[model samples]
Target: MTSGPECPLLFLDVDGPLIPFGSSSGHPQDSASDTWTSADQGNPLLTRLDPELGPRLIALGCQLVWATTWMEEANEVVSPRIGLPRLPVVEWPASSTAEGPRGLHWKTRAIVEWADDRPFIWVDDEISAIDRLWVDASHPGPSLLHRVDPGKGITDADFSAFDDWLRLVIPR
Candidate 1:
């Protein structure tokens, strides 16, 4: 809830980071076809979300913001399921595809703009080397562009990386 400049921003993407699309062993994507019902509102993918993630993310002590195509819908559909309260959603640019360089992810520029020179972390599966280069050149503050495996989702390793980076950017 704290979005002050002193707090580092954590721009979270819902798909690959929260819902693993890889193997059928650990993720819900395996039984999606058989288990989906009207109660799911047709989004079987929602079942892949880990309810335990909210507390883990909050413990990182950063301002969490939705940075997915789900937009504000992330607050309604994804939040409660993961125990997160309503969070600030990143508003993507209207011509996202048209603005960035070739191979650059569309969300890259807007995410940098949103951070506004404050330290930030962008977690998404779609991030590319081009996006990292762009952020390094354009963003003035510290940043970590962590790409998650869509097949595996966010792992404990990812949290460890976050902790490592936060230790450097945030004072204890």
Candidate 2:
């Protein structure tokens, strides 16, 4: 098994996916005015991640990266709190629509620029088939992109889904 957070890199989006985008009562702010509507705005989130999950992803030879609108926000704030290994920083692109605050094109572009021979999993709520197609076509090595609903939170169901994919892709 891999001993470092350098292979099977897992590109994580700090806002919507890792720290489910919501509040204390899980009040989902799906309104047009809720751009910064993540609990990450409230308190530290990753401190709450199940200890088992981090180790498991690492055991699978996965690395965690902050791939959100936060950009280097993780490097400044999230990483030290979560104790996640500091990986490369990714910035959002300049072509994102500024109407409602979602800038997925930027994320996609980041993925494209950051592509390498290492296998990766892009876990974000806004990714689509176009995203999957974009990376699969443009990047090197086998790729998996999972669109996790922030409303559901990263429950056991989430990990189970990831586990299924990992089992199929990772060699014994």
Candidate 3:
């Protein structure tokens, strides 16, 4: 099978989706159930990353792209720790001009622009109704703007939703 725009893109955000915060149990913050990596780089939160997530994400069969402020650093630090190979990074344009309607997240427009008519799933904690509306109006392809809970990060439920969507849209 050849990969193309039909192969959905999964735009991943590090802060909220991967390194969840504010949760009391089963989250990376628990420390007891989490594993620490030697490549901390003085950022303790890096230790909270669940290495298994990489395989889980890869299994989804989407082209994973780093869509966070971490940028290239995500490839260098986050990828290895999470057992993910280097993936594409979404570089935000060097300006503050992509303001959609009032409640949209700053990254909304850029994410849509990056997708460029390709089906994509944008996973971020800050998504809002405006962003969804904006994407629905602007992006001309199947898209899932999933908003993960910053407190819990990505859960099995999230993966289930992704699986359901992928099977329906990309069909493996």
Top-lDDT candidate index: 1
Q: How much is the lDDT of residue 104 in candidate 1?
A: 88
Error of 3 at 122 (Å): 0.4
Please list the residue runs of candidate 2 whose C-alpha ends up more than 4 Å from where it truly belongs after superposition: 3-6, 23-56, 97-104
Q: Whose TM-score is greatest here? A: 1
lDDT (CA) per prediction: 0.86, 0.62, 0.84
Clashes of each: 1, 0, 0
Two-way TM-score contest, 1 vs 2, winner: 1
lDDT value, candidate 2, whole model: 0.62
Query: Tens-digit lDDT track for model 2 on 1-172?
Result: 4634335667887666656655535433223323332534555454343334445545555666667777766665555444456667766657665232243345776675675666778888888776777677778776788888776545567678777776776765
Please list all clashing residue pairs in model 3, or write none if there are none.
none
lDDT of 3 by residue, 35-61 (tens): 434445577666568878999999888
Which tens-of-lDDT digit does each residue in 6-101 have in candidate 1?
899999999889877876466433333454344447776777887789899999999999999989888887787777999999999888675667
All candidates in order of lDDT, best leading? 1, 3, 2
lDDT of predicted model 3: 0.84
